[model samples]
Target: MDNHTTIAAYNLAKSAYANYGVDTDKVLETLDNISISLHCWQADDVGDFETKSSSMGGGIQVTGNYPGKANTIEEMRADLEKVLSLLPGKHKLNLHTIYGEFNGEAVDRDQIEVKHFQGWIDWAKKNNVGIDFNASCFSHPYAEDGFTLSSKNPEIRSFWIEHVKRCREISNEIGKQLGTPCIHNTWIPDGSKDTCVDRLGHRTLLKEALDEIFEVEYDTNYMKDAVESKLFGIGSESMVVGSYDFYLGYAIKNNKLICLDNGHFHPTEQVGDKISSVIQYVDEVLLHMTRGVRWDSDHVVTVNDESLLIAQEVIRSGALDRTHVGLDFFDASINRIGAYVTGCRASRKAFLFALLEPTELIKAHEDKGENFERMFLLEQLKTLPWGAVWDFYCLQQQTALDNEVIALVNDYEQAELLERGEVLV
Candidate 1:
């Protein structure tokens, strides 16, 4: 394909994807609805915590947890395929690869005994693919310190190193088999303050672990080059990849990439530097969505926030070409599709808002010493009228506001967004 076709391929792909999640019947209804942009599916959740009662992003914590529904591996994969077919070719997948237990006990990461991985790869191998690595580093209880959680003992650190090496191999194998890249969705369950945060001791150890993992082959035979990294699995204090400006320069120098997570950037307190954190190292944004109500875990985000600001930062950064926005959403209950739709819609709106935001914020930040941090979406929304912003920029052309109430609810799309916006897509 020539330059135009290559770009067209991406746009054609994007159109299908932009209206993802809504089913054929629902899709037409969605064109009638307006929130067609927010369409996705629930693929994986990594927390080992399970329960007798089922809930979104919770039940999967239990083993043998399919609830007499779609429990079998084949059955589960078929469920995945069924959902994909429903969306047609419009939507790209935010596939959360599973490292889940059947009932309760942790499934060995090294054991590729089952066909779950193979089945999904077989299905998505050639399509315009998108995926997320929602695996817990805690599955191997030995990672108590972290992936390379500063083990003093050579044996312990060696074990962790070997674990990473094994995972790399599995990742390479899977990526090669499917003709898709392996996304490194790192969530440090064992990470916390003084745990995996900013302490030089921990960062040094984490760096060592990272160096070791990168050095080790992602596969037994290094046929497939795995290009990936965890979005934010470090200390929550220093969790936001955009905030670590000092370290990011080093990461970029080393050819590593940052994968931004939606949940990890939450509460504002977490994502300090936002875009700048990954500007040097970011290759993709791993969209991790959940309800915002904290359950002492990464729950679903019921509302939107400064994430819009960050999305604009991403847009202005001119890194969209390098970005593959993958959602890591999990609803252990409520028919899976709910988790998918909620995440899909929210992320789309947030990004659309950012793209639509006037470039003046960016130029202003660049001109005066004013910080990009000062630019917030909600504040910008106050300036623009709802109709002008929504109808022209965000909503599908000629579509009425009643068609997609979410668009109205998310004022970022039309009013404030378009007047000063520059979202090319």
Candidate 2:
């Protein structure tokens, strides 16, 4: 907990890892370069400040009645400021189209433009962080039927196409202003609750709509496009128009980045294994780190085996430069700030654990056909002084070490969030 104790422990850890040919300093440096994008919706439970919807009509759901949820753009930004301060290194923020500032004026999805989000861009500039954008194709009147780009009606499909095009333009502007290429991700809740005979028809329309939406050329240096797929949703239990195969093939053909949401696949599918296979063919990929309990529940992430494997696959495959990692889980059941800090820290810890592994040693054994020895070394590396190294990293960052972060969150809730009472527009 103290500086001397932490320094001594780190020294011991450095020596222990040296025996395995591992460099603790190099691991800390590498971890510092990795920026995990924090999702903005987590602070507000997906309820945008601009809308007054009694119910979020999207197939997705954020089930919890937690107090102190952000109800205004100012509140959301303030909460995020606290979150960023609590985190280590630099990071980016993921923003949805609905989270724009319109000065309390009504702005429809179809009518959104760069002006609506200039405040966010300016905020990012002041904070010295990058911004990512997503088009809100759900929770609107147009998406009530669980379809957007794939809608049979020409008017409905065309509206969404225009909206996505504007979002891309906004993303390009954000990246141009921030000097970092923004990843513009697209996701639509288009599917059927029951088995439909028109599955092929929907996919066909979706492809045509996407082709039209991506017709305008934007500089890849400013922004890149990514398509996200989901297995199914609450109402769309039977079929999802943009299935994994559909987007995977589309991404390969169009040279676009494919987003792999951890909660979007079947229970048994290892998203980690898919990473190596995807990067071999695609130029780059985006990852939405989430936890799926039986299905795509979007619970807060933990330092579990799934996360460890995912981090290992990325590190072992040497795909860090090509992968854009971001947090995507939202749980209104717990403290909003707590959820953000917990998920982001868990991800960093996973990466840290993977970085501490004696990977080269294991790989050398495998190359020599010593399979059992490789497995034994991997199992043994799990019990090393990785925790001490992590503590040292936290100490160096001047952040709360271990469970101390919980106390910080609780103090903020009591001193600030609870006294705020009702949120104003």
Candidate 3:
């Protein structure tokens, strides 16, 4: 905490007009002033494009692909080491599996992990590298559409449980040594209401799988069903966010952590209230920071996009109780550093902005028995189309772009591949 005021977030732009106002290196220095723990670029950090999209005034809608410029631990570690050199001290790092393999691209390929999670741990430990924690989800070939456990097929579910549990264990061990928990930000791509029951099945599937995963009692005497049930099971519920409140309720009922992904709430739930419910059930919640399209939940974090409604919920949750921040983003074709640096910097600012707001605003509205957060937004909604306002916001953000190195960032708000330069885009 050398520069408590400088502990804000930062991003890597690779010198492009879109990032004209921010210097990649300086952005690192700036983190010290804002007191940021990590940088994030969930949605559009992995791809490269030549033009901005008119759809959202940020990124275009491309074929299936997740963003964030990293493919392997070696690449990610190199990028991380370089970023750290720019800014120093007690910082955190996060890369996500959100929209991962965007269109099944990350399909559990051996290349994603040349070795295994344990292999990376050994490599890091042997090199004496200062290890950091990771937040992840599966995107295996079996996940052609979704992860195995997300499937109804019992065989697939069994296969997925082992992979998930094994990885989770390794992640936990790594995090424990580094003083962080391997946060699991789960969001079922099990799309919403294809018909009705189609998606509803996701609920039951998740419940049974989790309960079974965590069913075994450590003690032989505590085992359920005496002779029929497994003996050494631990509910996998801790790593999931229930498909439905009932399923989520099951997790909470079993004392499991209900991880929250902000992007998943988009086009659906109210940020503040929804987050409050999660807070009521789970003590530790991971903040999924990614942007999206109108109906499609894209994971990019363009500063101009998003209503900042979700951040408000997180702030309130943090103020009222406890919560954990998990910066989530992917680079479909953009620079890894840029995805993390810029996304994190902007998010930290948004969070700080909320923190600076008077408690009375929420309280005063609450005093009058009104949902001030909702009321304030409601008042704005009455007259504003949000489009015009958003345009104005974009114009304002344009000025925040840095020019010295701005000319170098990918022109199209695409994702990055610097971390995976040795592999493929």
Candidate 4:
């Protein structure tokens, strides 16, 4: 749509929302300030630039051989820059420790340092973006036994503990250099595939390792810590060492942020419900937004019911300021850049729908115990002209509209991705 039509539609939307006491201008202003961190793994399908990299193990897997998978540091950065250009609003980049530029050196996980990621820090600075970090404790020979920090073998466990410690240090440096508090999230794939005879023993080991890793506290101005839990993974169907209960207690006791991955829960469980509950105890929470299909499949996010509910809960609970939003999914089967743009755009639309809600008015009805009125207003809201307001926002931000994204992605794929080289199998 052209700017004239978009503005016209937005005017009508603005007038419609005015009757409900919602200011579209204020909503757009607030939406512009919300930054969604884009995961780097999506560009290359989680194939990091490690010299001695091992095959994806410890329950992690990626399934596709699309052409133009970022096989080098330069290619990955270029693809990420393209993704940024197509997205609206300010955003941060989420990086795993394995994505660091090692210059073809044998930099083991335990030996990685800020020097390894200096290139990424410089690139982020030039592009005007902040960075978040993750300590990759999987896809290594040591993690082949389906345990890292919670491993019964002390040698294997210590390696991962040291790796996480270094990652935290690197994250702090990145934040300090960029003038933002980098959130360092730790997620380990420690679990049992079958009935475990020593559940308590593994949990105890994980706790000890975490305690030791976090012994050196960094300034919050430059860094914050979060622990992520998973229900189960490919090799951890029976028992996951870092369950939600374990991380919840650990985060509360240690005054750390708890990561709520929407895909890391039971298929029937709603992560949106847990957000309100977790924030009552912790000062802040990290949200890894992704979709799951019957399991933790890590599908690209769309503006589905679950996504809308999650955004609504964040707005309804008044936790916008206390929550950090980040994307966490990879789909190499399609155009990688298209996947990134689609996921980011869909996520923003969900939040836009939430922000456009007449929340105060609806809550007033509920507060008065007017159940029928509240239900009616909610059902009516489903038909609101929120998409018109969204189109206007996209125009204002100079991004591709919903209708223009596919053609732009196709042009790039033909001119860039297809020319890169042969397809990977």
Instruction: Please say which candidate is ahead in lDDT: 3 or 4.
Output: 4
Q: How do the residues 321-347 of candidate 2 rate in per-residue lDDT, one tens digit apiece?
A: 898889898887888999999899889
lDDT of candidate 1? 0.42
TM-score of each: 0.57, 0.97, 0.57, 0.99
RMSD of 3: 12.5
Better of 3 and 4 by TM-score: 4
- On lDDT, the stronger of 1 and 4 is 4
lDDT of 4 by residue, 1-425 (tens): 88899999999999999999999999999999888999999999888899985798767777777788888989889999989988889899999998988887998999999999999999999999999999999998999989999998989998999999999999999999999989999999999999999999999999999999999999999999999999999999999999999999999999999999999999999999988899899999999999998988889999999999999999989999998999999888888998999999899999999998999899999999999999999988899899999989989999888888889888888888988886565
Clashing pairs in 4: none
lDDT of 1 at 13: 36
lDDT of 3 by residue, 1-425 (tens): 11221222111112331232323333323323332334333323433121221121111133334333444344455556544433322345443322122233433421223123444445445533322232222333454434345577777777665544443444455555544344433333333222244545765676676666555423211111100000011122122223445545654576544544445443554544566776676554445455644433444465442436655566555532344444545545444455555665456545433443344454666777777664784354333222222222223333222221233344222334432334322
Better of 2 and 3 by lDDT: 2
Error of 4 at 155 (Å): 1.0
Tens digit of per-residue lDDT, candidate 1, span 1-425:
23343344434433442342212223233222221111123333332222222232311232222221343344444445444333312344433334322354444543422243454455455544433333324444455444333455566656655555555555566666644566544333333424334455555665676576777545422222212323344343333222334245535655544544445433444441455566555444433444333422344434355445555566667655555455444555433433444454455555555544446544666577666544653355444432233233223333223244444323522332233323111
**Cα lDDT, all candidates:** 0.42, 0.90, 0.41, 0.92
TM-score of predicted structure 1: 0.57
Model 2 alpha-carbon drift over 4 Å, by segment: 51-54, 422-425
